[model samples]
Target: MNLFERLSGVIKEELTSLVNQSIRQEDTPEEEIERTISQMRSKVMATRIAIVRSSASQARLLKKGLVILEEELAQAEAKREALLRRISQANQRLERATRPTQTPFYKLEEKALELEAIAQAADELNWTKKINS
Candidate 1:
């Protein structure tokens, strides 16, 4: 072979070797980047799942609290109704007790006069008996 052809062949071989080495170096970093991205995606998915579970647990607790409050409200309403009924009954009794009687003033005066006359007659009879004995 001529000197020029041999030199060209050697140059081509060196360039090919440099290209292959650079490609290998680039491939390793690309694969590492892909693995890091996959790890980040998995971590994000796990965080989202935890948030969803926490939200669900809080919702259940809130629902239970609401139910308890509703029951308490119902009981309070019942107690208030009973108190109102008792107040109504007390008011009725007070009205009846305070109402005026049907008896007239002239009838009471006549009863007093009759009682006084009976007392006077009994005293006179006892005095007469004592004097005779």
Candidate 2:
């Protein structure tokens, strides 16, 4: 065989060997695609879990706030009732203070005493008998 022909053949054989080795070293496209899909699914699951946890926390906070508001409402109702009772007491006092005397005999007695005292204070006036008459 000629030296040039042998050399060419050897170089061609080396090129074929290198291509096969590269193919063997690299993963198939299908395997790479599956690995990426699996990683994305895991990330999605984690995100879903985080959202659920956040929602639960918010619900708990709202429940606490509602309880606090209800307690405040109860306190306000109690205060209103107390104020109403105090107002009723004050109204009763005002009514008692402003009401007129009901007995005619007591009214006459009071008037007679007032006139007697005034006539006594003024020596020249004789108004007690007039008031009694």
Candidate 3:
């Protein structure tokens, strides 16, 4: 049998033995015996109710623990996302500073700026030559 079943049988035997020992006196009246049994039954019922309430209290505590763990997991995930975003930003900044020639966009921008500076210089030379003439 399961441990709970064995434990229940043991408890039943002990309670019955105690009740029998308490009421076994030959001088005890029949009505008094009946009253004693009723009171014992009430006490047993109260004990059962207390056990159920204790189990419910434990269940509530377990549920609260689960909620706390879920909240912690969400916070950890948010931290992981933030860390990844920071790493990506840092990598982009490093690439721009150290490897501009390796990136096509930076290379094109640099070429455009150089060409604009050359055009401006040529325009200035033409303006000066016109003034001289």
Candidate 4:
């Protein structure tokens, strides 16, 4: 991966090197100037293409990450709603005060809150990523 990025830099440097050598060795200044300008234009265009391609790849990866994040978020939301219903039932049971086996809503509520926190974090991360990409 690093090698691929470094190759772009290497290509740019090679183009500069060749242009400098041509400038020093050519008999006619006009010919050297024209050749160097052509080489520079090609290098600039190639760099732009490379940048666009990298941006496209990053966009694809970010989109895939968002898809996975969305599916996980949907599941988290479903779990939260189920827990809310259970908590409501527990409250109703508390009103009757028939059983003393466990704490009514604390544990389930705890897990629901934890999942909510994780979902929020994932959402923030995804937003930042998408904007940057």
Candidate 5:
């Protein structure tokens, strides 16, 4: 596998780990949360770098980018869950912890859920079109 593909796998694993870590904790350390968010930020950097590296339409290059993106999506799926967990955890911990009362990206969470719904609808539409054709 190429650099992008490897990076993508790393990012996905990191994200998955972050989700697992966050979920397993009765109380998470600030440092761990920061590390998780930092890794995600790095994943964004890796994605942008991969996109910039999009120079040719060679099968390998194309595949490399796609794998990275797939990893990113998997990571995002984990993130979506983890974010919800964070929000829930924050709410539960609100009276005791110094953390904020709500998750920072409530609107973003809603939007992501909306996008997933749209994607599912599009898939159904495409399947219907194929059957009709």
Candidate 6:
């Protein structure tokens, strides 16, 4: 009876150990699944953060580029205006250079009368009498 009691005690201990090991095995898969889910959540959060930061950086760069484009547009407008003014000035100079110089009719008539009076005075002078003699 003593030997039988010892054998029964050993068998009971072995069954208990196997039951505990099976429970641990079952709980291990659940723990590993939970850990995997947590790691995935962390990766998703990190990706979202990176995307947000990249978007902000891209926005800043685009804003800077817009500013530069506006400045260039302003400069281009100023240069265009300056070129137009210069072209207008050059056209005015060209028109003036190509214009014909015209003397007034009144000035020509006055000069003709003055020449006739000088000729008449020269004919009455003794200088013409000596030349004719």
Order of the predicted models by TM-score, top scorer first: 2, 1, 6, 3, 4, 5
User: Over all chains combined, what TM-score does candidate 1 have?
Assistant: 0.36
Q: Model 2, 1-133: lDDT tens per residue? A: 3334533654675577557656766776545444444444443443344344445665455455445545655565566567668889999999998997669987999899999988777754546656777
**Candidate 1 weakest ten by summed lDDT:** 42-51
* Top lDDT hit: 5
Candidate 6 has an lDDT of 0.59
Per-candidate Cα lDDT values, in order, are: 0.60, 0.59, 0.63, 0.64, 0.69, 0.59
- Model 4 worst lDDT run, 10 consecutive residues: 42-51
Tens digits of per-residue lDDT for model 6, 4-82:
4533654675577557666774565446545444444443443344344445665455455445545655565566567
Q: Candidate 5: minimum summed lDDT over ten consecutive residues — where?
A: 54-63
Q: Which digits, one per residue and each the tens of the lDDT, describe model 4 over residues 9-98? A: 756788778777857754564455455455545544544444455666654554554456455555655665676689899999888786
Return the TM-score for each candidate structure.
Answer: 0.36, 0.36, 0.34, 0.31, 0.29, 0.35
Q: Which segments of candidate 1 are over 4 A away from where they belong?
A: 1-54, 103-133
lDDT of 2 at 1: 35
What C-alpha lDDT does candidate 4 achieve relative to the native structure?
0.64
Candidate 1: pairs in clash: none
Candidate 4's C-alpha runs over 4 A off are 1-54, 97-133
In model 2, the Cα lDDT at residue 92 comes to: 100
Q: What is the per-residue lDDT of model 3 for residues 63-92, given as tens digits with 9 covering 90 to 100?
A: 554455456555655665676689899999
Which has the better lDDT: candidate 1, or candidate 5?
5
Against the correct fold, how does model 3 do in TM-score? 0.34
Over 1-133, each residue of candidate 1 has an lDDT whose tens digit, in order, gives 3334533654675577557666774555445445444444443443344344445665455455445545655565566567668989999999999976657786787788999999999999999999999
Model 5 stretches astray by more than 4 angstroms: 1-28, 56-133
Tens digits of lDDT, candidate 5, 49-98? 65566555544565666677667766865876788799888888875676
